[model samples]
Target: MQLTKGVEQAICIIVLLSTQDNHNPLASDTISEHLQVSPSYLKKIMRKLVVQNIIRSVPGNNGGFSLAKSPEQITLLEVVESMEGEISIYPDTGLINKVFRDGVHTSKGEAVLHDVFNGANSLLRDYLAKQTAADLLKRTMEQSEIPVLNWNITNPSNQNKKE
Candidate 1:
């Protein structure tokens, strides 16, 4: 089963929020600007995250978005589920039963397929659940190729502008 682009953005948003200093909230505009994504589209994803309690929104002028829970507390699976809903790798459409008339063979085939798909789904979910946003952030930080960023700075574009 493939995940949507929203899921990828949601995870990145979490990683961005995790970089906030002094527990300060980062504005959606800032986040969108940094990621080079549309603010409107990011809002939709952020709304889902807020509803799932993955992130929180502030209402004042100095308002923005922040993590509702700690990075260590947020799981990759939680973010995935928040964006895409529950994961169901196999769609039980009953097409196999419809095409195959032999009950014994049909039942055996269905059982085997179900077992394999279920196992795969469970493995994926378990792996995701075990990996937290902090874990991902740490791994990312360990990579020399990726630049470590400070979300608290007045740096939405990650560029040096001439004054």
Candidate 2:
């Protein structure tokens, strides 16, 4: 099943936060600018993450968002679920019963289909739960030359805020 754009953005936010020198909080505006997402949309996604305890919000002049847990403690599944809710890839819509004229045997067929889809969904959850944000961040760093820029230092407007 296809996940929402918010899921992708949440994952990216986790990776970005994990990369920070001290896991420093990142402003929503800064994140939106970096990810090329609209500030409003990003805020919605960020709010979900916050509710899940996957990320925490920092308030005040130099405040923003930061990870509530270490990257190693935050799994891919957690971020995905935070953005999209529980992962139920397949929901039995009872369409199978309507499609087959043999209504008597439809229950068996539906059961069989349900078992198959449930197995697949379980596998997906296991795979996602096995990987953590640290895993993604590590892969990102290894695959590309990610210039390390501390937001407090790089963003001049934020420099005075930190002081």
**Top-scoring candidate (lDDT):** 1
lDDT of 1 at 103: 97
Model 2 misplaced regions, further than 4 Å? 143-149, 152-163
lDDT of each: 0.83, 0.79
Q: How close is every model to the real structure, measured as TM-score?
A: 0.83, 0.84
Report the lDDT of model 2 for residue 9. Answer: 89
Q: In model 2, what is the error at residue 144, expressed in angstroms?
A: 14
After TM-score superposition, the amount by which residue 50's alpha carbon in candidate 1 deviates from its true location, in angstroms, is 0.9
Which residue pairs of candidate 2 clash?
Answer: none
Candidate 1 lDDT over 74-97, as tens digits, reads 999999999989877999888889
For candidate 2, the lDDT comes to 0.79
